[model samples]
Target: MAEKGKLHIVMFPWLAFGHMIPYLELAKLIAQKGHKISLVSTPRNIDRLPKLPPNLTPSIDFVKLPLPHVGNLPENAEATIDVPFDKVKYLKIAYDGLKEPITHFLKTSSPDWVFYDFVPFWLGSIAAELNISRAFFSIFTAPILSFFGPVPVLKGTQEDRTKLEDFTVRPKWVPFETTVVFRLFEIKRVFNSFTGDDDDVPDTYRAGAGIEDCEVLVVRGCSEFEPEWLKLLEEIHGKPVIPVGQLPTTVFDGGDDDTDDAWRGMKEWLDKQVKGSVVYVAFGSEAKPSQAELTEIALGLELSGLPFFWVLRKQRGSADTELIDLPEGFEERTKDRGWVCTSWAPQLKILSHDSVGGFLTHSGWSSVVEAIQFERALILLTFLADQGLNARVLEEKKMAYSIPRNETDGSFTRNTVAESLSLVMVGEEGKVYREKVKEMRELFVGRDRQDGYVDNLLGYLRSHRRLKLEDQSNGGQRN
Candidate 1:
């Protein structure tokens, strides 16, 4: 322990950028309170993270551990971004291989607490062996956590059996009225891709073990946004569940620099558009759509006739390289009304612009928080994990609209995309969603309230430090 009540904490997030970024944000927050934080990840991921704020350099350390070689996992493919969706399980296998190195680090460092993500279900037992208190810092929202229920449900021991039908409807635990279940297509995709093969560990088991092993469950949401769900989480888990605010990202805080010529051009275009008239479309760093899906999205934007700024993900060479090309003459037809950027366009700056009226997104929790902080309504078309759960929650709250899709096959047409875009962008029905987001913006952007959540988290960590068996008998805390 450091002098004057400061803590030495470890932060370990999953390999995905979505999970790593939030864990980084939380590390900074805790460091700001005069604690020392050691954030652990692979070498490439640490290098890819935004440069640390100057003042934070002394208080925070980035500990890089090399991922062990695993058969079939590409060389240097340390993160999910480095590989395709199908190959992610190999990344997990590689991630788990870090047990030996992480054990050496933790045993030497002997930190006060280790906060980790839902992946690495094995971490809890390791922390236990070392007698270091551990926390499961969830980057997901409360509704989804509640939907997955306590450890029993996540481990497939509940009455629901964790079957396909079980996911298509809201679980019985949520007494409040909500339509927060997966669609047929969504659940099938999850079952196929996320649930691993016989040799691979399933994601559900990971989440369960992470929750079961944690001293406290920390969520990336606030009580103001989902009080009932937060409350339900505590009851179901029979443990302390904390909400550390939304942790909203600011313009150019810790991402790629945004002052390039490309951003300047996009800014100029945004300046010329009418206020609240443009739809900013992005599906985050992950969630690559198929060629058919991408073509439909292009035609849908064209048919909607609304001004759009799309940040399309560049396709990798081996993954459908041939079909990756855009529809012929697409740029020629939509040149006047749309601009598609293949490179990174600072998302915070774009969403903060006056012209960006709505976000057409995959409903990733971080993206949704960023958009709401700027009062931009959502137009959801979820394609990957937990996004459908977020879309359903927002849809139930009447604060967003989802593009219609076939229930069984989960296929959506251009017409449905156009219609959903129109409804959320400029149609009469979109007014409710627009106003609702504006009203909820305070919950996301209120810095003071957010700071309070972090302070409370620190207080809990301090009070509940891993006490030695002798100290516990005398009610003494370790630090």
Candidate 2:
């Protein structure tokens, strides 16, 4: 060890871009406090990580671990993007193989703490072996976990939760008024996407183990937005839960939109529109829309007759599917008022643009935080799992309007999509939502507030420096 006062932390997030980026952000933030961060991941995922600041580069090290090749898993397919949705659990199986390599690194590195993702529930044992403490870096917000609840619910230890429809209704622990649960069709879509059916072998069981085994639950949450949800987590897990404010709340204006070629075209498009007039649409890297859904979304934008910036993604396995899904002559007709992009756009930069006033999102937690951070009014198009619950939270908080889809089956029409987009972007109902977005943006993701949460977390880590191997009996306890 270099010194007694310094902290050495190892971070390992799940392979998904959504999960990994947050862990990277948190690692960067923690490094700024003069702590060393050993961020571990497969080489492919590490390459995909967002750029880290030059000043923090020396303190944050990438601990590359090779992904083991498994049968049926495509060569070099180490992340969620590399495989179809059904093959994700195989990625998880490959991830579990890292325990041995990671444990070896921990043995040599002697890091004080390990901050882990939901999938590596076994890390607790590894940390314990190294006389190191571990915290689960929950990229999902408190509400998602609070609503997903404990082992009994997740493992279907109880009879009711085993079925798909059971989760459509609120979990018993959640407040019905603000409860955010999956829809029935959403439930079917989620379970069907997964390859496994046994609750004992599902990802939930693995995720909950980390929560139960960790010293504490560190979440990307802030009291200003989800105090009740935070409390619910504490009650359910009976462990210390720290809301490390929706992170990366730095005072950043993004690259010079006017000068940078990366954003030049997008900036030019926005400049052509009035301030607070464009709806920035993205559904994340995952959540590829089907042909029918893509058509509806495309026609929805056509029907809305508003300025928009839509990021269209090609469906996996087919390279030209983006062009195939668009309604005939749709792009040509909407060219003046809308822009369709097939590649990745700098999401935060687009959200921060003056002309971008609203967002049409999948309501994934990362997307949710990004929208709220920029004070963008939301038109939620929640597609799966926690996203449905996340949409409900925004609706209950009045922070955004959840699009009304078919109640029994989650199918939505182009008209409703147009109506929801119009309402969030230009209609009278959107006005109040925009106003609330501003208030929440200031309260939840304010730069100073997020900075303070990092400081608090660092302080918590420093307090654990004196912990020794003999404290095994109290390993799960958090201060």
Candidate 3:
């Protein structure tokens, strides 16, 4: 290596909090191993760094890049969570412009390795050209990686399988009893439209889209969660599928005094509640429900009569006016039993708390992982992306239950919402799910005497580096 000083690493993540958060944790872990890390993102996001943990701030260097202006994008829309969906075009253009600066930075800095997310498909070839080893860091689980990677489908070779009636047709290569929905084809088409060229889609996207390729896959897994999927991924990839597990306490590190106070107050309120008695509801940053849906949800929560905490975003779009009304005196009616918080909350801390019996989530992979990590029983109400698939997997595994949606549009009705809330929060079914959740929590969180996921990850990283060094030295001798 470089005179036994420190290994330099560069990390580039897609401009989204869900993607950036995990990569940030990995970077911190690398830094702790005596490596220098440079994390590159837009200037707007870079400005938010001061609000993060001191350890994350000290261990990593931040590179602020300008967001190239494209038509229709707002001036201040650079932060991962702030960017709207329609401005994805501008983001692609901005990212494309970044390639040159990234190349120059690599040439000057000469990092030993580059860790990148799926959005920058071209980075692999660039890293190879610059003689830097590259690793793909997937924030998803192993089954997700395996499902989206170059695995053969049972439905035979076809470009678009939507025309086929039975979407549940398993692939020839997949050993498990699996089924695919026709809607997945529609999702692929949408993603392909945005990326411009089909060739540029990452291997995972391609595999999910029915294209095949040979590439290394990395996932976030541990011995306790989905071990079978991890084993299957290794078998399919024919390469080491490293499971770094969950990195320790980083996401909740930031926030001002006011924010901290709010979190503490919420925690105190939760602590007073009995175990498995509360329902936690949050739709991640990207998901904004319609006014009608939001009203329905509010009414449903009120009808459930369970102790609940709901996080509501302040702004609804121009077309949606439902949240503003709130059924006239609805807030007062539910004041004693329920709480509604505006803006941000410490999500990870809330999820891990004892009183949170069930999570009513949008089923984002990051949220799913967090829920699993905390071993909370779930009431899955998926909205978009692979979230539907995640919900299906959880239901199939009997780990969580899905809220029944409208047959025509797959949207949740108020009745369905109320029913699901009652089933997960206070009904007989809730008790059974709670026991299963407790067992899973014990498995993942581990016992008082044993080391949990974080320790296993640290051990894995050390062994991985040693093996890499051995391989490099052996190859040099051969040369």
Candidate 4:
């Protein structure tokens, strides 16, 4: 007979790198425990997935689903990285179209558990129809989930939908008073996206609907970082809220970028810098800064008088443009101490190096977790989405300093950026933040600590079996 508790898990993540990476990590952990893992994605996304270890190759298999063709979506554009932000919605529409193909796969795979991302409101119904289990995997931190609260309040028709300021004050579901909400402009940017142009239904609706339907929340966070908030979510959701740790990351050596001229150039310069004195800067894959913001950040780095390495992704739509306009002669002036790369660099290798001391980042969750794993102090300049909230959590822990922006205009100046970066890398405050993050690194990177949370989640999933007969009686439909 087959092993009783040995389960088959299907992981379906959204088309964003931030979402897919964590889900892949979780799948790896579960597969390490001898459970089977089937990772489902569109063609290109599966091809681009992080290289699985040789051992895992035996336990996991990729199940490709063809993205449905949609008007205005570029051919082969199946993920957020494949299109610009404005075109991302078209990708979402195409993602929703995958329901049929995914359903077909589920019916055939018939896995014991299906772990899906924040989108895909229809998957719960599919799971119910198949009489298989469903779990929602949140790639966001506990604070982001807590800030949104439970499904009822966020999905309620009674709430106002126009002005972001209405919901930006604080989440309605938090029983205790707290100052955990987005700043005005951050709210404005998200609100602009929340109410889409055509508005058949926003992805937020899918998120909330999926939340209301899921059996549990398998989060990429740990109690050490967010105990109070995690507890609050369990109470509010009336279902299990499992913290899966930050999910340990393995650093890549001699990665795709290692041989590129920009990578070699940065490495040669970085090798000469004093240990723990250089700061590495790179926004995540999707955060494309505007020309004005880029100019300000460039000026700020120049004036900081510290050795730094900045990765400037090629300008959008114009792949060949090497560098955006920096202050005239700035590169020549700081050539010895400041090195800028116009291509992707090995961020994991750079951060893990002894010479790197701080990270100037856009505060994406995956980047934050990786920086913490390497004990690097953070200088957060949040750009979009949940980044503002993630920055606040680090600031609350005294582990990072966020750049100050104008309260009304939400614009930050070159001086403020310089000051924040300096304070985090060289000032007395930098020392305190560095020490605090170092302490956190031990807890964050410990294999035993991470495995403990995984063991708990695995045990729960093993014990919580539902009656297939009862589900069949209910027409085997997802609610």
Q: Can you write out model 4's per-residue Cα lDDT over 1-479, one digit (the tens) per residue?
A: 05676888889999888788888888888888988899999989998776887888888888998899998787777777667667777778888899998998899888888999877878987887787788988988778888876675456553544577765676656776666678887776666555555833565667777777788889888888788889888887888899999986663333554356766666778889999999899998777777677888888888788888888764533322333566788789889899887765778878888899999999998898889888999998887888888877888788888889875556888898889888988898678888888889867778999889889999878766535434657776432
lDDT of 3 by residue, 5-49 (tens): 456778887777777777777777666655678999888777764
Clashes per prediction?
A: 0, 0, 3, 1
Q: How do all the candidates rank in terms of lDDT, highest first?
A: 1, 4, 2, 3
Alpha carbon deviation, residue 458, candidate 2 (Å): 1.8
Prediction 2 global C-alpha lDDT: 0.79
Q: Would you estimate the TM-scores of all the predictions?
A: 0.95, 0.92, 0.81, 0.93
* Residue 291, candidate 2: C-alpha displacement in angstroms: 0.8
Best by lDDT: 1
> What tens-digit string does per-residue lDDT give for candidate 1 at 1-479?
95757789998999998998888888888888999999999999999886788888999999999999998787788888777777788889999998889989999999988998888898988998788888999999889999988797677566464467778886778898788989988888778544568758888878998899888899999898899999999999999998999988743355456556777899999999999999999998778888888989989999999999999986522332333556899988989889999876789889999999999999999999999999998999888889989999899988889999898877889899999999888889889999999988887878898899999998888777634434867875432
The local lDDT score (0 to 100) that residue 212 gets in candidate 1 is 91
lDDT against the true structure, per candidate, is: 0.86, 0.79, 0.64, 0.80
Model 1 misplaced stretches (Cα beyond 4 Å): 157-159, 251-259, 316-323, 466-479
Best by TM-score: 1
Question: CA RMSD for every model?
Answer: 2.3, 3.2, 4.7, 2.9
Q: Which candidate model has the greater TM-score, 3 or 4?
A: 4
Give the worst 10-residue stretch by lDDT in candidate 4: 314-323
